[model samples]
Target: MVSDRNMLANILRTELQIHKSSFILGSHSLICIFIYSSFIHQHGGRFHLSPLREL
Candidate 1:
């Protein structure tokens, strides 16, 4: 029974870590997109296709 409890605790801890990391990554990407869009907006809403073409 004690081993089962330990396993459950470990699983919960790993799950929390995964969620935290994912949230951080998601927020980072969101911020990047927001900044990029704002930059384009400042430039009269013209999206430069050169960068996409490079990709």
Candidate 2:
């Protein structure tokens, strides 16, 4: 029973870590995109900095 509890706790900890990492990754990407767009606009859309523009 103690081992089961330990396993459950480990699983929950791992899940939380994964969630936190992905959230961080998502926010980082958002910030990059915002900066990239801002630069493009400032440069008069001539830079073509992001390949994601075709999407």
Candidate 3:
């Protein structure tokens, strides 16, 4: 039979994991993927940026 302490520990661990996942993929990473796909695809026929611009 499992003790109450062990059951509580398991529940707490699972809750911690769920909370930790919230910030795994912030907006910055998502924007990077979007920009890369838009700027570097279609044989370079996508959005045209001035030389002074940088992502």
Candidate 4:
């Protein structure tokens, strides 16, 4: 029973980490896309990606 509990805890922890990482990655990509699109619109479609590196 103790081993079962430990296994369950480990599974929960792994799932939590996977969810957290995916959430962070999704938000970061969204921010990058938004910034890139806005930059393109502001600069008349010219592609200068230097500012995105700062973020």
lDDT of 1 at 26: 100
- Worst 10 contiguous positions by lDDT, candidate 4: 46-55
Name the 10 consecutive residues with the lowest summed lDDT in model 2: 46-55
Query: Deviation in angstroms for 16 in model 4?
Result: 0.5
Clash totals for all candidate models = 0, 0, 0, 0
TM-score-best of 2 and 3: 2
Residue-level lDDT tens digits of model 3 in 1-55: 5788899999999998877775565666887777667666743765655422754
TM-score of 2: 0.80
lDDT agreement with native, every candidate: 0.84, 0.86, 0.69, 0.89
By TM-score rank, best first, the candidates go: 4, 1, 2, 3
What are the TM-scores, per candidate, against the unseen true structure?
A: 0.80, 0.80, 0.42, 0.81
Pairs of colliding residues, candidate 4: none
lDDT of 2 by residue, 1-55 (tens): 9999999999999999999999999999999889888877877887774646643
TM-score between model 3 and native:
0.42
Query: What would the per-residue lDDT of candidate 4 be over residues 10-53, giving only the tens digit for each residue?
Result: 99999999999999999999998998888888888888859666
Candidate 2 off by > 4 Å? 48-55
| Candidate 1 per-residue lDDT over residues 1-55, each given as its tens digit | 9999999999999999999999999999999798778768767887776644433
